[model samples]
Target: MPLVNIDIIEGVFSAEQKQIMIKKVTDTMVSIEGENLRGVTWVKINEVKQGDWGIGGQTLTANDVKAMAQG
Candidate 1:
């Protein structure tokens, strides 16, 4: 069985977007491993606290990551 885990800070994602992400990730795993779809297990989404995460010695909020990526 293939196990998948996705971790992200709390935020709003449309249901359709979540489903699509799951589908694409699972499908990619299936193609790579040649495993049955039914054998795959997707773990629940994990939300990390902003204060608990850091980048470059500074606590990184969700907005910080976005802003840095855009620059």
Candidate 2:
């Protein structure tokens, strides 16, 4: 079994986007691990609350991420 965990700031992604991410990640794993492991592959998305995730000594929120994406 292959397990993949993805962590992202809450509100940074829509529900549909998250689902797409899971599917894509699973597909990538299956491609590398073989079709036999598809059933045992696991992909999880973890959300970190806004203002609770920090990088470069500054807390980041969904808006901050959005701004970065825009740039």
Candidate 3:
């Protein structure tokens, strides 16, 4: 079985987007590992608190992420 874990700051993605991510990841794994593993493939998404995630040496907030996306 193949296990995939994705971590992102909370509120960065909507429910539908996350669902798409899960499906796409599973499909990719199936394509690479063969159809038989489809039933055994696992994908997990973890959402961390905004301030708990950081970049460089600074802690990041939701607003910080939004600004980064705009630039």
Best by TM-score: 2
Which sequence of candidate numbers ranks them by TM-score, best first?
2, 3, 1
- Point out the worst 10-residue segment of candidate 3 by lDDT: 60-69
**Candidate 2, poorest ten consecutive residues by summed lDDT:** 30-39
Superposed Cα deviation of residue 64, candidate 2 (Å): 0.2
lDDT of each: 0.69, 0.96, 0.91
2 or 3, which is superior by TM-score? 2
Model 1 spans > 4 angstroms off: 12-16
**Pairwise TM-score winner, candidates 1 and 3:** 3
Clashing pairs in 2: none
Instruction: Quote model 1's TM-score.
Output: 0.68
- What clash count goes with each model? 0, 0, 0
TM-score of each: 0.68, 0.97, 0.88
What would the TM-score be for candidate 3 when compared with the true structure?
0.88
Query: Model 2: per-residue lDDT, tens digit, 1-71?
Result: 98899999999999999999999999999889899999999999999999999999999999999999999
Flag the better candidate by lDDT, 2 or 3: 2
